[model samples]
Target: MRKDLFNLGPVFGYFFRKNDPNRPTNFNLRTMHFINKLSLAMFLVGFLVLLYRWFIR
Candidate 1:
């Protein structure tokens, strides 16, 4: 949505930034939001699992 994000492409786009109006809608905004949240959830879960393993063994 912002000018800065346009240069970063889909990596930042996955973090809930809306697609710029001039760009194509094939990616769809809602899907981006879902992916962002899912990614964050997985990242947190993975971090916790690693932390648990680090301390448990």
Candidate 2:
């Protein structure tokens, strides 16, 4: 439905939350964080590679 596509509250809530070290995280929350960090790191590496090729060529 058109409503589902526009309703982004849940998605935003999932990624933007308090980071309390003393508070324990469930398996799903930990997994999401890991994946988020991994993807961000990969993106930076790829961007660097692109810039290097651009400068050399």
Candidate 3:
């Protein structure tokens, strides 16, 4: 519900947690996850740049 939609705990967890033993991983899945993490990192960098510009202006 609303809490689930707004929750950031899982997002931070995904960045920090160790891989699960029972989960299956493959080349494709690993590549996709890497792309996702990279995109998120890029987005965060862009957002911070915008914020810095706003504050410095």
Candidate 4:
């Protein structure tokens, strides 16, 4: 469970890979993926901020 929580494979795949030729595209799916990417990016930013504060303090 902990390993799964930390796994970044799907995150990298979603952000870096070319679009799947065989995958179905729809408005709902696009919205979901966009939201996921947005959230991940926000999380990374927050983490970086915390790390910076830790080192500065």
Which RMSD values do the candidates have, in order? Answer: 8.0, 6.2, 1.7, 2.6
Candidate 4 residue pairs that clash = none
What TM-score number comes out for model 4? 0.78
Worst 10 residues of 2 by lDDT: 8-17
**Could you tell me every candidate's TM-score relative to the true structure?**
0.51, 0.59, 0.86, 0.78
lDDT score for residue 56 of model 4: 82
- For each candidate, the alpha-carbon lDDT, in order, equals 0.75, 0.81, 0.91, 0.91
Over 1-57, each residue of candidate 1 has an lDDT whose tens digit, in order, gives 688756756664656576578865555765786787898879989999999999987
Number of the top-ranking candidate, with TM-score as the measure: 3
Candidate 2, 1-57: lDDT as tens digits:
576888868756655676889978899988988898678678879999999999987
- Candidate 3 lowest-lDDT run of ten: 1-10
Clashes (candidate 2): 0
| Residue pairs with backbone overlap in model 3 | none
Model 1 ranges off by over 4 Å? 1-27
Per lDDT, what order, best first? 3, 4, 2, 1
What tens digits encode model 4's per-residue C-alpha lDDT throughout 1-57?
A: 576988879868879988888999999999998998899999999999999999987
Candidate 2 local lDDT, residue 36: 88
Compute the lDDT of residue 23 as modeled in candidate 3.
93
Off by over 4 Å in 3: 1-5
Which pairs of residues clash in candidate 1, taking residues 3 or more apart in a chain or in different chains? Answer: none
Off by over 4 Å in 4: 1-7
